[model samples]
Target: MKRRTLMTSALALAVFAAVPALAVADTLDDIKARGTLRAAIDLGSPPFGMQDANMQPTGSEVESAKLLADHLGVKLEIVEVTSPNRIPFLLTNKADVVVASLSISEERKQVIDFADPHGVIQVIAAAPKDVDIKSVEDLKGKDVATTRGTTNDKEATTQAKDANIVRYDDDATLVTALVSGQNNIMISAPQIMNAVNERRTNDPLEVKFVLKVNPYAVGLRKGEDALKAAINDWVKTDLANGKLNAIYKKYNNVDLPAEMPKP
Candidate 1:
């Protein structure tokens, strides 16, 4: 009877020991254990993530990542990604979370999960405020600059059939071309549009026409409920406390919508 009892007690201890290993399998636990949060951000996209006048990284997304890392109680390791590779980096374990301006879509949902939307991005045709681009017809025979593999690319390639679409790998390159007078018209968000004006005062850019507005959210891996729930809660708390809104306004120079769209 004593031998049988000892065997059962050993078996129970073994099972209990395995529980912690299983718990740590979640990405959230892994991040904590690693003592660093790998946040993927697209530094090329201003107001989201970009360098300041001193070439130091500073933007809404950069701050957002900082907030997230703070909440996680871990050090932040920014994994810079372009629009095309953001999702890939997350899926391949190169990043633990994607805080880039990743627009939530049914198509993207099919691959990975997203937390509640933190903000919205408007895709539009923009040019110098002096240029009158009242309609798509006004874009005829013009060169349109846009970042490749982005919703902007899809919108421009689909809508502006007559214009020559010039695609770059990222927003920074595309914006540089615009500021240098290589392309007068381009598809971009209000954040980038405003950035253009700050850099090129002579030809202040303005939205010619809006293409679409999409709610952007943090990207997480599918089946990682722990990580997803943590981010969702973080977004909810910060959004309610006005921290997220304050950060958004500080960089984007605009307030987040009063009624945020559902993710």
Candidate 2:
């Protein structure tokens, strides 16, 4: 009876020790066995993730996802997502990773794990060149446009307290409102403002002032330490090789930030 009890206790200890290792192996093995890495991304946010004229996904985030897939020796599959849906997709196992321009935040950290930042984005106030806005204070009493439920909208609301904020469903509509004179100002990503300017033949829009600098990273399901470590390794290696900067330049027409955080 004594020998049996001792063997049972030893077996329990071994199982407990293996639990963490098994949890770490699950996601990596599933991804490899499936032979494809499904990357969730927003298909309408230009310069980070968007559908080009051909209606195929293209941009910095898409390229980054492709790089990750290549690194893993797997085929790449893109799953379109909105900002609010990005986390849900991961939680539901609909995507292996989210490569959208998801900003790192304390609230988000509660639900998912973020790899080392792949890039940085600045949220800014943009207006037509002739508009005399020089700062957030200048937006008082002016009509401002930004996508609903986004950091841009929140910042614009907080900083330009007296401004009339027009919330649109997506970046495309927000840009349209600015171009059509429905809004005199827009709070958005700098890359988004540049994308809008590239499409216009008239007076182009320009960033007035930056509201916030956000670090963007790949989102993984919670507790996937092995996958997170692998992604961080890839990001660090790419940063060292100049591959990440090349991808940023291809879509943003600028180099990656000089002070990007190291992995």
Candidate 3:
């Protein structure tokens, strides 16, 4: 009788212990109970997430976040975060989820769960208005500038091994280097290039030779199966309902792919 009782007690304890992690018990639940869902984002990347001249957060990710929060019947809170800090922010419970422009990668999958990709971005070469550069190959032996610690830097280094690939701490400095003639071409996403061109009156910089295509998704902490599934299901529904495409089209001139890439 004691053995049976102990087993019962243990099972009860196990069930109780799982309360904090249950899909019905996680931050998603807390948000439903408390009535607000907070998200973390990198505000520097425009058309994805960024502040306008009025300092209000506006972009594809931001609008999607708002839509999700609304669908969940909760208020939405925005937390500013950088690329390097996104995982840490989610892991530490600083945010309920991350709507940042985080790339979905196998390496990252080991640490965090990713939702169905909502958009695709690519790294390409951006050159001055009159520069004769035609492709990534033309960048051979020329100077290339890319943002430090980004996929841009890695791709640039690999494609232009002999070219001087300089890394800047931020996009601003990288563009500054390019505009000042310290670098010949810049490696970055077309969205970022568009942001730069918006500020420059001298016609938009030309982009060419797409190096790599990156799909972006919302990120969640690992081990949150319920939350992950819920978020994924929500994304799928949005896609089916045409809500996802509308959000992306509202912010970017580019269109999003209809389905997530296969694993």
Candidate 4:
């Protein structure tokens, strides 16, 4: 009877010891154990996340993800995702975190959590230098191009109800429509539109009006407080150390605003 009691106590203590390990098993632990951080990015959006001339993923968001991976001392696995799929990728566990140019919105908050603002992105209207689109109202009766189902599209549709809004499949296609003169104006992030204009000296596009100022943030799966805190801590450290500013300047050709908001 004493031997049986001793065996039971030993088993209980062993299980108690294992419980703590299981309790602490979280996304961060899984990431560390896997030795790779999977970062979802919108590879089509230049200056934020895009492929470089060598076909390697290179952009501000890509660099930011790299920074996180380096901070965690792990390799980065780039997962290409579209704007609409960023949340789905995270929820489905296909991506550990989304480094896409994701703007924080209340609707999205219901499903996923966001880290502090990593950068500020301006959604603006761009037009050929000769075009006279100076404001949202100026877009009336004009052909404006934007990606379907994006904030730009929603804002343009709402503000310029009478405008001939042309919807494209993605930002690349929308920019193509604008540059090809299929559309008189395009609403997009300033970084990408400016880059496109810089490449086209024949017909340079200029930002006519700023529509929205969005705080871009990293998206993580819901309920992952540890992961979220780690990401925010990394952002805070990098922001103070000028690492984020350097990355932003490298891709966007401008420094990140000193007063950029934190989480």
Q: Who wins the lDDT comparison? A: 1
- The TM-score-based order of candidates, best leading, equals 1, 4, 2, 3
Model with the higher TM-score, candidate 1 or 3: 1
| RMSD (Å) of each candidate, 1 decimal | 6.6, 4.5, 4.5, 6.4
Residue 178 CA displacement from its true place in model 3, Å: 5.2
For candidate 3, the lDDT comes to 0.77
Considering only N, C-alpha and C atoms within 3 Å, which residue pairs clash in candidate 4? none
Per residue, candidate 3 scores C-alpha lDDT tens digits across 79-191 of 88765577788888889888976777777788888877777778898877787777667877777778775667778887777777877866556656655567657888888
| Residue 78 alpha-carbon offset, candidate 4, angstroms | 0.4
- Candidate 4 accuracy as TM-score: 0.86
**What are the per-residue Cα lDDT tens digits for candidate 4 across 1-263?**
99999999999999999764454348898899999999999887777877778999988899999999998889999999877677888887798898988887777788888999888888899887888877877777877788776677777788889888888876776666666667767877887687677656798888888988888898887767888888989989999999998998988888888798543
- How well does each candidate superpose onto the true structure, as a TM-score? 0.86, 0.85, 0.81, 0.86
Which residue pairs in candidate 3 have backbone atoms (N, alpha carbon, C) closer than 3 angstroms, thus clashing?
none
Model 4 misses residue 125 by how many Å?
Answer: 1.1
Candidate 4 stretches greater than 4 Å from native: 1-25
Task: Find the number of clashing residue pairs for candidate 2.
Answer: 0
Provide backbone clash counts, one per model: 0, 0, 0, 0
Count backbone overlaps in model 3: 0
Per-candidate Cα lDDT values, in order, are 0.87, 0.84, 0.77, 0.82
Sort by lDDT, best first.
1, 2, 4, 3
